[model samples]
Target: MTPSPATAAVRVRRAELSDLDDLVALEQATFDHDLVSRAQFRRHLDSDSARVLVASANHRRFLGTALVFFRKGSRVARLYSIASLPEARGKGVGTALIEAAEAAARQRRCQSLRLEVRIDNESAIRLYERLGYRRIGPVEKGFYEDGSDAFRYAKTLA
Candidate 1:
């Protein structure tokens, strides 16, 4: 049976242990040397402080993933990782995931969301800027495994 276009539209939801392999593949596809290993994904999957979300078409075709970390007794949530598959770039997958992350944070009583993006990621920077996230601090040198610098971005949720 053919699937409806609406059904195929990217949908963002919490990641599950069953999505381990897909999440790992997404990490590999999204980053080079600094890939998060399977064990790390496993830990995040089980962690109370972390929320792993995935964007998929029809709930089966993986398109992207986002990992958010929350601290107990803290109002700030960190967007630790977010990436869209190369084939899914510019298709609104990233935006959907970001919106989902923000909703999750707000639901958890977080007052704001912060993330670090590589300085060279112009597209991502543009997306964040368009979404109302602002640069908050000095550049973080050698933040990535490949020695790339990063820029911190923050968005108030309240």
Candidate 2:
């Protein structure tokens, strides 16, 4: 049988130890360079300063994941990473994860949500802009392991 489309319906929640494998697979499949290591993901799961949100269809099959990082004595939250399966692209999986991240940031009293996307990620750029993120222009040169430039974007929370 075919899998459900993430856009049809999605469930977003905090990542648990059981979700480590799926999260790692999604990250590996979604990113080519600057990939998040499994060890880092494990650390994030147990870190209070970070929120690891996972998205799934029917609360079973994993569709995507998003990570939000918070720092003490700061009102800004950074969206460290996000990933979705190829079949989940153009669906609501990515959007749902991002919104979840924003909500998590707000819960932590963040004034804004910031992220850096690869320069070549036009699709992601469009999505971020559509979600009300303002472009902060290009970040440091060769920010990725593959020497790719990245663009910074942020959305202020009301």
**Local accuracy of candidate 2 as per-residue lDDT tens digits, 47-89:** 9999999888755567888999999999999999988888877
Which residue segments of model 1 deviate by more than 4 Å? 1-8, 58-60
Alpha carbon lDDT at 146, candidate 2: 88
**Range of the 10 consecutive residues with the lowest summed lDDT in candidate 1:** 1-10
Would you give me the overall lDDT of model 1? Answer: 0.88
Question: With candidate 2 superimposed using the best TM-score fit, by how many Å does residue 129's alpha carbon deviate from the native?
Answer: 0.2
Model 2, residue 139: C-alpha shift (Å): 4.3
Q: Superpose all Cα atoms of candidate 2 onto the true structure and report the RMSD in Å to 1 decimal.
A: 4.4
Which one wins on lDDT? 1
Write candidate 1's Cα lDDT for 1-158 as tens digits: 22224324778778898999999988987788778899999999889899999888754568899999999999999999998888888878888888888988999999999999999899999999988999998999999988999999999996
lDDT of 2: 0.86
